[model samples]
Target: MTPANARLARLRGGIPAVEVGARGIESVARNAGCTRLRAIVISGLTPTEIIKHVFNAEPDIMSPFAMTLSQAYERRLLENGGASLLTAYREKGHLATSEVKISSVADHAPGGGVLARQRRELETQRLLDMKHAGNPLAPNLILNPRLPLALVGVTHAIELDYMVASDDARSYRVGVIKSYADRGGKTDKADIRAACREAAVGTLALRQHLESRGDDPDLAGDRIDMVLRAPGSFVPRLFASMRAESEMASLVRTLSTAPADLDEVEQLVPAGTSFADPRVINQIPNNYRSNCKEHCALWERCRAQALAAGQPIILGDAAAEQLAAAGSITRALDLLDGRGRPPDNRAEAALATELRAAALLLDRIANG
Candidate 1:
């Protein structure tokens, strides 16, 4: 994948993996349904951590999200639709706006590199000044405003989807334009969640930019507005009430903390460690979930690992929670058969009792 795509993954999935994984580790002990030790081991590793380890192990090896042709087409369509929506906003004169469509191809090409970014930065500043001047028709809406930030020690020119000025021209909040339809202010949970995560990162980046410019980062609002089209139509709708403070706090924490001892891990891994062989890539462990297949290419491999381990989690979240006390498939079966090891605590004991009663009910039903 491109650097842009990799950064997107880090924001949407990698950062979240680290945040939730930390929580999973902390609460694993108290939760009887958790595979305490196993969860702890896995939770300690983030997607970025695994990625860094493998990348350092072999510079030539890159683990990018693999997408099918159809998936790619769908993404392009959505992006084009978002672009069209932005153009529509300008055409309809919703607000005075300055839009700079930074072409990835032109930006990365020779001679276009620094100049292209410099131009965007200048334009972004100009728009900000206009907004601050309280010019009613000032470029209150800025599309693709570049905000720079460091991710995993690499400096990146991050861009917000849209930076909108408040009517008072005293503050701004980031807007994420998503193709997901807002049907009476309702949409797919997963779609909204992903969009929110993306917007949170943009918000954080914008705040960072504000701080660098000697402005109060608080001027960057804790809320993110998701601009979407109505279902089955090109008409745009703005979901402006989505608050992201809680999620943004988690993201900000994990992103700001840097890990130690990566150098040691890199030294230990053998040279020429590349993704050339499927077997080699398989050797690197990853936390697999049912949702992994949505954005991860190695979904099938990870799914196989879960299957081989007989992790009930492979079925669903509910199954994982229900079987948590059982810990493993073998243990669950043993409990049902009244041949499992003695429960270490009251919770497991109670779960065992329930399992035995269910087993008896199943036996009776089978006999009848």
Candidate 2:
């Protein structure tokens, strides 16, 4: 077989491995802060009605706006940020010997060949040498650098925006270029949180690389420098080394635990769970919420179900959790209007009493 065909074959062989490895971090994050939810997502059953088929839960939905908007936003951010970074680095007095050099990983895609291996090794060594030499511009604003890592029964080639030297000079931090404008030195909270999550993925990959090379992995923090636009302007602003140690640790643990969950969930999947029929897919149990509409493909159907059932999840997570004691809107309303009795449990009864009082207050105000 020709070299190209040989490369394609090798890539095909590693497809499952890549899925198990590369998607581990993302799957882990998707189910974060809730283990049951993790089980659903990691099983590849999330935002699907499969769970509903089994448990009579809501249909799965993905909000088109959330997914499309974010993808477009990130693409724009990275393109602009790359140019901005080169300029920013040069402005810091580091002269680019030539028009900013970027190591394009795609030229050698579907790796494992000797040339590909050498290219990666050379880039890795260059970064290391710069770090050892305390070169502030060691990573050189790499356009798309791939870091190879193996963890928790999976292996992934993690791509990063750029690997930059940290403030300490001896250590390095992942450089995550975001498009969010830093207004008054503050960006959107949700955007910052999402950026940090992506940064953690890069950091984990880097730390794994460092450990494999016999370097001190601890020196690498789950931190990233967010390069974004200045508040109300198009100029780049450098936000140095924002650390999210807790987020990083949580990510690692979640990914580490995901493989086992995936195994179990796959086992639970029925033999005839094909998507040939829309009704079959709708039978699958799904959890729906206001957030689901932003990212899930099945958001509309799931949302209709939530509205029909009057599930508090139609509001959002906080409201759903807050009203969980009532179980449904109708039950809560019944309690407030003195038409339905609260459960015999003390905590639930207390909640009912509070709702009743609030309802009475609202009634009095409305009448007045």
Candidate 3:
């Protein structure tokens, strides 16, 4: 097996490149699963923390969904019609839109019977002319070591609810993963807590349901415990972290036969886009989604209304800056350092406490 440091280096430096035109919001949303839809914020830690301990990263791709989607879609398109249409489309637009249109002279206007038949024949034969590859997105996105945050939890078990595009002859799925590995971190107690307070004001908010420190964790790191007395009418916040780490993956794979751009590859994810007719959600008897009670970030509004006829707070996507803020490595350091703020977790706080206690030991080791 590759050594852990090598793996960390590879993840940092080995990302693929994509043409500029291929970049879009879809992939970003899919990678991070953040859209203008119902949004929530979350925090925790996992594999990423360990990697940071092993290898330093700057300007990391915290979440990359578009690339994951492109990987899923391209394989399907190329196989069905060969690469001519795809190639042509790419040549024309370079991969920005979610839709495409194809046309032939024979289909557009009347041609001689022979000419029309030849045109149809041309399409059939042309597809056969080019050899095609099999699916690439199915296994890799799921198996990648750097799974997405949406697929993880405090328990570290990965939940696979990723996307899929299946039809006759082949299938590709982007399995949703959940693990504590990508959990958000909070060291900026004032900043993050302030934001949380803003988010919680309308609802009966949180008072540190749990705490952690870096000294030791009941689970992974040190832990923090809290007692939350809420109206029981609150929304459990969950940020749209990446469902797939297309941006973070080193080097491209079979998604394309050649070198690829991680930036462009990420544009094809579908998560940030809207779902079908969200407005009609209340009309549906059981609601279009059975798990909406738990899944919806606006669950508080839903619960409040159902319980005590509370007024509605419309659903919206998680705040982008806030989500981005939670994942900063600096914040991790703060949690570990405890310089100016409260440690978000007991594990982090304890580590800081120890680091201060062992400052001379740490300095001696650094010099050595």
Candidate 4:
């Protein structure tokens, strides 16, 4: 076969990822099916989605140097340092404005190839059976310089959320972030307030998702109230920010009752910004995508620790973790510790359904 044909074969097959990135969402989708792909994307790295998006336009994304869709996203990500989407703008003194780069967008179509030539497959990949799907926007992402961070934003589409959450036939979207300071081996006041902010931010997000669908049929009697839990995400960042027990205690009042004004919540975000930016969700930094319960390289360690000691072992060497306070960090670790064990059988079975559907999608592609 010619080199181009050979390259196509390799791209569609399963392969290990290269670069700072640890894995690929496309391969996952290709192997498991679109539903599984979406769930993995939602539960895996944030850049994996972007990488998948980018490659959808340019299938031959690999370089002789070994730049997989995974690696490129990481390189672009770390270049921005620790800046979340909103901070990238504020740090540059452009709080109210920013641009979403286009070259950063995915070039490949939905089924591992260019879209214009093969449109039928894309429809199938998107229309798989779904319960409650969510569409996450990277803010004009497909439009120059891609946004630096994965800011949290809310979208109202049923397909994407199910895809992200393994299409469990459930409709709810949730996100969390926590920050703290590390003063030697202790947590301080700064750390406490930060942890408080993390909890508040997550709670507010849950509130938004719940309130947005208040009168909708999905919720009225059924629970448009789908579970919006992310204690693990919020608690860690808070522990990173608060270094002392007292500091953490001081923020208790605010945590108990989130203020009407967002300034209180702004205190939680490292960039000191609010959700005023229409693209707040899209602007959230995607750096932590892979670090969640599902895909972190440290999962095994945490699993052993949680099973043995009943807690999370979140002592990452990343600069982001070190910068946070001990209190916030510890709380997050505790929350993660709680999640180490697998979900209850019911949830697991739902997740299994998603994986099978994804595999089916891949089967369709392989046959074509």
Per lDDT, the best of the predicted structures is 2
Each model's C-alpha lDDT?
Answer: 0.53, 0.58, 0.26, 0.28
Q: How well does each candidate superpose onto the true structure, as a TM-score?
A: 0.64, 0.67, 0.19, 0.19
Worst ten in a row by lDDT for model 1: 28-37
Q: RMSD in Å for candidate 3, one decimal? A: 25.3
C-alpha positional error of residue 46 in candidate 3 after TM-score superposition, expressed in Å: 32
Candidate closer to the true structure by lDDT (higher is better), 2 or 4: 2
Model 2's C-alpha root-mean-square deviation from the true structure amounts to 7.3
lDDT tens digits by residue: candidate 2, 1-368: 65533432332222222222223344446445434344334432343433344435565443576456445544554475456566666675543445354444434343866577557646765666566556656544555566765543334456666666523456667767665667753656765766777777778877776686688887776667777766555577676668878668767777666335334433433454433234534444556756544344456766787788899988778778878888888887776666756475776687788887877899899998
Highest-TM-score candidate: 2
Q: Give lDDT for model 1.
A: 0.53
RMSD of 4: 25.9
Better of 2 and 3 by lDDT: 2
**lDDT per residue (tens digit) for residues 1-368 in model 4:** 55533332233232222211112321221222222222222222233333344223222233444334333333332234223432333443423344332111223332333343234223322321122234332221110111111112111111111101112223322112212223434645433333333332222323334454352422212111011112222111211111223322332332233221223323333353222221332333222222333333322322443344322223443523332332233433433334444434554444445445666798899998
**Candidate 3, after superposition: displacement of residue 156 in Å?**
36
User: Residue by residue across 25-49, what tens digits does model 3's lDDT show?
Assistant: 1122222322211111111211122
